[model samples]
Target chain A: MTDDIAVLGAGMHPWGKWGRRFVEYGVTAARSALSDAQLGWNDVQLVVGADTVRGGYPGHVAGAAFAQALGWQGARVTSVYAACASGAQAINTARAQILAGMADVALVVGADAAPKGFFAPAGGDRPDDPDWLRFRVLGATNPVYFGLYARRRMALYGDTPDDFAQVKVKNAAAGRANPHARYRKAVTAEEVAASPVVADPLRLLDICATSDGAAALVLSSMSFARRHGVDPVRIRAVSTVTPRYPRTTLDLPDFATDSAAVVAPPAIGFRASIAAAAYAEAGTGPADLDLAEVYDLSTALELEWYEDVGLCPAGEGVKLLREGATALGGRIPVNPSGGLASFGEAVPAQAISQVCELTWQLRGQAGGRQVAGARCGLSVNQGLFGHGSAVIAVR
Target chain B: MRTPVVAGWFNADDDPDGFRLLGTRCRMCGSVFFPRADAYCRNPSCAGSELDEVPLSRTGTVWSYTDGRYRPPAPYPGTPDAPWEPYTVVAVELAAERMVVLGQAAPGVTVADLAVGMAVEVVPGVLHQDAERTWTTWHWRPVGGPV
Candidate 1:
């Protein structure tokens, strides 16, 4: 496509509980990206950061935080927060700047030093804030939603718990080869079953943990990429869409869904729309995708993404799984980066990390977990409060 | 007397007929909100400014159900110093409002006891009891269960 931004470089400060300030991880990832792009920090014209709410004040202004940590160049800085979609928004902001002829080169960074255990909302008796209210009133944690989804799938599609465990097994196997992943050990279904249940139908291993990590990308205008004398993976489209009103499905941190009484529900659900928009913008379809890196916050959710991303029809995600279509060396491997199953979740950096995996796979650089002859790949994730995120990259 | 954990969420009356989860409905578009949107209607197509408080349907079908097997972190008011107890949660689809409302299942209900499409009804229940006050909230119970 003519409208494209070259991913000149991609890097990460591996996913784990490092316990350092989020800024430190951002700077390390940013420097690695700069090195990968064969450019210096001084060469970056713009810096875009995806914010982490847990990092206190500095995380709120993450763009400048990373800039300051990298010794302060006079780069135009922007910070964005969209919950888990923060990284995609950061990347989108940088791409817009580059495309607007405002900057030839832009750096995008996202990092997080997440808290341990079930993520809680900002403290307070704020009944008006749905995130806080859900906790205070319902005691509903993130895994609760995952459990509901998993159980619903089981009842509707006859998907057994064993089907869910296989997803963890496949992803962990992929993660074992990924040096940046937090958990390097391969998991078996027995191990997943043995883990204690955090929420009914979902065990500790089935759900992703909170982690500390960061990811960075060096992006530039296609013309700039040519001038730099490097052929690179290019972002064909970035989709950030909100659900159409009357959103009936229950999402995270919400007490209730938008009533579909007034208007008929949208033809496509919110999660499905994320990737549909990207495909529409790229003038491509699911068949054009060589691989995908979807947010597998829970192993069952990964199966949902298989349908949401149009790899299979609705209710057939488990069937696709049974056929081994989503596993590595199968048709259209998904979560070849181990996904949240192995890496846990560093919210702000996650979407960017997905794109980082896509960049590596598309460029034929993903050593052991590479999708052979991969050319086009997409990454999809949804953040709280109706933030939809998806990116399509091609080489 | 029971104090609501969050006032205006549901009626704290012990009478079964009087207990109903309170929400607001848009007069313009007939849309409903559980955490009651009194300010404006959320329907994008309608610019309804007036949302009237309405008692949601007392009975609904189970959309989905799960349980918190671990004690949730702070702000949940989990009992201090006591061992954690798993509690069931359910998402019930009110046919009248055509929206799903989430709440804790009636005391003692487990994940094994619930199923999708099973009929459930709202009931007044206690969330937690402080030294001076009993914090009240809504709970969903199977339609035929004890009141």
Candidate 2:
């Protein structure tokens, strides 16, 4: 197991269509995190920013951009872009820097000001880009892939539309209590059903919307935390894993899965392997987790995460949800912070926001949506391309 | 004038099986890659570089299906001036290759006409048309259905 990095502070700019720049949101979140940590911008020796493509050239160099916005103290900087997994990877970078004795305190931030409607690839005729190829050739939007997964669940697991609606209902109820969530109103199963269909087998509410949001964290070495006289929540592990070749399950931005003809498929699926690696590094099993925050880009995807995280056996995610095992007051609450169902998506910021929620829950600071006596929490998200990340944190 | 949306992905030859998807097979490991793997073998265990062009199976079973109820963004060739027409998409699983390939369903095939595990076959179809050229692409059609 790797040494733990202290989560000294966590903060965010409330998610919404704020119509502002991503850099502004990120700087705001960074300031809030710095305040919470009782540290100044100059105190941070390293800064990592999760990049957003929509921000143009400056966004590609997000770490330096945020540093300049925060009145550059000439901190060492790095930027990472792993699609949806960007935030987790940024956190992983900060953790590695602290563990390697490269820095005593590190600032990690991710923010996005998304465009309206469906996300499209960058302009130009790049045939080699899978994101462009899918849209150009197949007209396959992201929801189409989500719809595929939802339909597959119905056929394989007997999960009904009502079952899917329950996920939105549960998450929306929790979202109402989160001040940072964009959609705070409680959503009913009826509302979900009433929502227009964006993709077959999944309605508009089943899929998350793109929005403007930002989340930031201040991570420090254990010695720094001790010197500051702060007992901080610790990040135990950050598992950033890529898919093994011959992945059978169809994923986003891909017209086809790799063939298994040449090699045998891995015993553990990609998503499952993501969580397993985190659990292995954290020296804890799913049973030890008091709460979890997962990438619920779609309601049905959340159910898949239950099985992927080993909360229950495969194909029994619906059964566990039906029994209220994953609800806010359940034995092991999942997404008590309302998940992406509440926050929608801010791309680079979403995964970091997951960790922010976990940090709050672990610190017993999650107001009404709190998982009672939460001690250990997990955050799992998969990015476009083959990136998958799972982080474990403990108080 | 007419053109394939992306060339070399589908057969242009007049074969009896109609149009089949083209992919590359690793000579050493026998791994088949669609959208054609012209480079090195993707299999992590193999370093073999020899790849042979081969036509994939024309028939596969429906693994999952969905419909694009809303218009997609740019690069999709959906005319901005035209009213959006929803199209059904199918992910077909080839048993021999043990891979799931995604493609647009034949025109007029809606979600109502599809079910998981149903038999489907690949057929060439038009994606969109400009003043000069028609973009051709592969579409999945349910077997024994009206086309």
Candidate 3:
């Protein structure tokens, strides 16, 4: 497709609790990506940085911050913030610029230095902010929402805690070989069961942790890749879609779902629509996918994504998991890079890291966790508020 | 001594029969918003500026439920001085409004005690108490269960 852009290189700073500034991690990732592309700093015409709220004022202007840290080459810069989807937004912006001929070569970077324990909202007495109100009013931490979804699945589809624990076990086994993943040990179902419950039905090991990490990608116009005499992985589509009105689903930071009384609900739910738009743009479906990197904020959410991404029918996600249809050497592998189950969450850096995993897998460079004959991969994640994104990459 | 944790969320007075969550309904589109949409109607198709405050339906089916095993972080009003206690949370779907509202489960209602599609009703309860005031909030309880 004419809209496609070549992914020249992808890189990441290993996820962990490094206790460093967000900028430092970003710079490390950017330099590694540039080197992988076999290009110097001056070769990059644009720099797009995914913003991190925890980084103070510099985080807000991340584009300029990264450019400055990389020793300003006068590269045109842009910064975007959409919570967890920030990295995907950065990638989308870079792809758009490359296709529009605004820049022949672009670098997209995202990184975060997260705090310990649960992520709290910004300091304030402002009652107008829904994020703050959820904490103050209901004490609804992110895990609470995860627990709600997990329990609902159990009630509706007969999913058990064992099924949820199996997801962690599979992902952790894959993560054991991934150098960029934070937790590299193979986790057992027994280990997951032994972990304390953070939220009812969701144990400590079943939920993703918050960590410090960074990811970067070097993208170029297809023509630019041709000039370099390289046939690289190309980004087929990036869908950053918002939910339609009368959102019936109760998502994060909100205490209620929209009323479907007046306006009828959308034909497809929000998460389903995200991947549908990408499939429509890429002219491909789940059958064509070699691998997927769905956001596993909680083990249960990964099963939900299997349904949302059209890998299987609704209420059949657990069945797919039970049959090993989603494990490595199965019909289709998910989170071959171990996903958030191993890497934890660095917020802004997360979505970009998914793309990085896709790049490595498609290039056949993913070591022990490689999916056989991987030709195309998809990455999907949902952010706070209404932001959701899915990217498809093909070799 | 009872003050609402967040003002205007519910009718916090001591009348149990009259206790109901307040929300706004759009005049032009009939769209309802809880936590009150006082500024303007949120419906994109409707240009009507009037949003009337209305009390929501008290009873609804349990869409889902969960409980916190650990105390939440700051702005949640928990202190190290007092031992932490886990609390159950419930999301109830109102038939009249065609929406789901979330609140704490009434004291003693655990995740093991609830199931999906079980009917529950909103009731007034205390969230936390400081030296001077007992913070008031809404809780959901099974319709025929303990008071």
Candidate 4:
């Protein structure tokens, strides 16, 4: 409820296929963040790293990997995996440490040296895994679910293909100003339309690409921040909540949706669940957001995020887009960091990167893409396997 | 093949001729769940109550369709030695239950012939094979189109 932890530094390894080890990228970013905070790795009492399953060995137990990479000094190590939300969990872990007085200063890191082509699950025959069942049985890639949600919006709310394209266009323009963004060239709706359709109603460009990258943050208690003569933007709340069962609206990798027959589903959908937790903890609503950095895996998803974040009503998402309510100069700007729409998928680093964008924006340091006079910010992203990660920050 | 009642609804001893989708209906709330939620009712508004197995209507409208141009990973039971052949996936909205069910389409049915809102029916098929048996699953087929 209180804004107590100070975010002293945020840094990222530019997202793209560098063919380097994930540990290398994370160490680079961690050192950059440490330098940004004018501290040494030894001063960091805790280090948290987001795990990337696709990157093999070191990725699975990322906390220790990064700690070893940074030349371990016995910082407490913990590894938590929640698919894409791994980075947020890492951040949450470090926040808990600083908040509980477990440690005065903590380092959080997430990095991924991604595989080429479509993302896949670890090799195994585990019927217990729903993600595996969907791929083996339905071949439903993540984008397939995104397409389904997009088309469902069209069926229920009259969202057009053009409406979806506009999200990419806006984000692409903003991405041009982002030095760390993988795709820096501005894109047009026509370019989006002309791109090959990977899934019906969504094109190659409509979906974020696969990239190898890393992101890290330095967090500390208020006392630690002042002791170093370093000022920090404060982190007000972090939401690592999960969905209530009867997750009726179809989610990725589920063969059949949770039947509302067993019980009435929650009034809010999964993304709303993420934002709701942040709002409750921060004691603020969507109207209070100066800027937001959301997980825009696909263009249509950005629109869905608009409604889920409560910037607009459920079916009125496209209407909000149409009127520029979510654009750069709009009343409540969304994905002003250019979003995942331009950054591609880096798995573990993506969510942490969302926070990095906000930390920069909150400090008035996000030069070209800065949300004008921003004071409050939030990052909203849903991880696979029901983990909802949202963080609210205020200056 | 010993098929799971859940797997049977989508890809198992798929009796093609009498192809019926399976689901669970809450006796208390009259709401339905695809892939069958036999344990409980999903409507949070309804007090947790009894559930009954129900056959979903064989016919539903196409909500959307797409193909995985790339091969999906493990737990799907495909062999890397074999050249990857992509398959189409469909999401159908059952008007009867107001739910969207997802499944693979019958082999060879491309996205070319499918359109949103077109009527389709559920049929059964092989999901994967082992030395001993074929794992069955359900496939959605467009009515009057190629099988």
**How much lDDT does candidate 2 score?**
0.92
- Pitting candidate 2 against candidate 4, the one with the higher DockQ is 2
Clashing pairs in 3: none
Estimate, for each residue in B1-147, the C-alpha lDDT of model 3 and write its tens digit: 878998887895579889999999888888999978977888878887888889999899999999988878878986856887899999899999999999999999998889999999999998988899999999999997887
Pairing residues by index, what is the TM-score of model 1?
0.98
Q: Which stretches of candidate 3 lie over 4 Å from their true place?
A: A56-60
Flag regions of model 2 displaced more than 4 Å.
A56-60, B13-16
Estimate TM-scores for all models: 0.98, 0.99, 0.98, 0.89
DockQ of 3: 0.86
Quickly count the clashes in candidate 2.
0
Model 4, span B1-147: residue lDDT tens = 555424434333435677677666778777776666666665656665677767887888898777776666555667878887777788887766667788888888987878789999887676777786767777788987666
What value of lDDT does candidate 3 attain over all alpha carbons?
Answer: 0.93
Report fnat for all candidates as fractions from 0 to 1.
Answer: 0.88, 0.89, 0.82, 0.57
**What local lDDT does model 4 show for residue A319?**
89
Error of 3 at B111 (Å): 1.3
Q: Is candidate 1 or candidate 4 better by lDDT?
A: 1
What fraction of the native alpha-carbon contacts across the interface, defined at 8 angstroms, is recovered by model 4? 0.57
lDDT at A336, model 3 = 91
Error of 2 at A283 (Å): 0.7
Write one digit per residue (lDDT tens) for candidate 4, span A171-279.
9988888999998998889998999877767888888898988899999999988897866788888999878767767777677666554356678878898989889
State in Å the error of residue A388, model 4. Answer: 1.5
lDDT of every model, 2 decimals: 0.91, 0.92, 0.93, 0.82
